[model samples]
Target: MTLRATIVRPDARIVVQFSCGAASAVAGKLALAQYGATHDVQFLNAFLASEDADNRRFLADCEIWTGRQFTVLRDEKYGADVQNVFLRERYLKGPHGAPCSKLLKRRLLDAWKKPGDVMVLGYTAEEADRLEDFRERNPDRPVIAPLIERGLGKEDCKAIILRAGIVLPYMYRAGYSNANCPGCPKGGEAYWRAVRVDFPEVFEARCQVQDELGPGSWFLRYRSGPRKGERFPLRELPYGPIRRNESLPSCSFFCEMAEADIIHKEPTA
Candidate 1:
């Protein structure tokens, strides 16, 4: 009698980091459309307390649109609170980066991400430089940036999400460019001013964080004059019209993998 051998092969896992922004939402959709049959694609989110409360609503909408639920990861130590990360680390922003990015996102990713899992992000055609920077830093990790490959930009991503009948998050509607945590430390003068006006509670919370971190801790910068490159405090930022041109760098954990979401026809505020 002859015996035949049987082999089993598991589908490769494609982990999409969905940050609840339009770009990421579209990217996740694209990844699913392309790989859902051949690969085990999973959407992941590094939830932060600082993001707008409406992010949860947008997240649910995206899940319905995509027909796939996200595996949410968060900094258990800080309960995914950016402020707690800052306070515990005894630091805010610096030349390297912010502690919240490190502790809230990256560390959680390191713990949860598995070997042999291909990662996906929302880097668009305009962000090829960022994609390249991430690859240069994380040569060992396999990644697939669908937005970049498809020549899509942020607007394209937003359009795609809108077509899918999902409402964009409140942050984007409010005129802040990206869906990063409200009062993200990476914001500039205009960004902070927008935060102050649109999200006064969040702005004041960030100011309180700076006060807690104490001297030498700052989240803004002086664009010109002798103070150029000096750390500017959030409280000192003057109220003014927000310049819509500025966009925040993506703030997911893997951003340092380099580094650096959405919905809807939701009407712009």
Candidate 2:
């Protein structure tokens, strides 16, 4: 199957988000194939100090695949540090999401985007529900979900990335689902335990951040599931939990909060 019929305004710049994952890489390549020669298209990433170095290598390989260099967009004010986000914002997440996502990613998108740019995301067909939710929640965003449009799945994306001669990010090889921050709060007990084993230093740093956030502030907060409000300290987690077949939420700079300047959306004062 081919991509959906897309029209690129000659003057509109296409802003493709590369999250250092296979799906995003495939989306970026398809965007270039469709619009790069005739339109202004650029790839962007919200870098974090906490992301794996493998992410950088994957990005470099993707750059070669696209034949275009990425324009790295960062929120210098936050220094893109997860711990800094907790200390300054005084919390990890709120009604919206983790503060680090808003400050580092959404804020920069807010600053860099303009009227004629269309934001493109790599939500594969497997994520049709998320794509639908994003469309419903963000009617104002000039965004395109290409993978879903093309009926591609995660495995399809992996094949596409391999066909381009690029290696998948190390985390994917190491058994993590996505190449998000090593200690991303979107993870659960099992995910954190994996982090403790695969990324010991990152695990220690997140432990420090959780302590700094004080009691009751944690990575996992299940409101309705069996693990309701399970905010157990990562320090106490045993290694046996690491092998559970569980999932972690995917992280996107924009999708995390859906909007920048979420001061009014803060759950805490």
- The model with the greatest TM-score is 1
Per-residue CA lDDT of candidate 1, range 1-269, in tens? 11111121255588888888898888889989988887799999888887888999999998888899889886678988888877778777866677788778877788888888888878888988877756655666677788888789999988888888888898788776778888787777887777787778988988888888776787666777798877777888856668643776877655755643111222468
What number of backbone clashes does candidate 1 have, counting pairs of residues 3 or more apart or in separate chains?
15
Model 2 lDDT per residue over 77-172, tens place:
878888788777777667566778778887787788888788788888977777666655655556777788888998899888877677889888
lDDT of 2 at 24: 86
| Local distance difference test, each candidate | 0.77, 0.76
Q: Please, what's the RMSD in Å of model 1?
A: 10.0
**TM-score of each prediction:** 0.87, 0.86
Model 2: how far is 267 from its true place, Å? 14
- Candidate No. with top lDDT: 1
Alpha-carbon error at 127 in model 2, in Å? 1.1
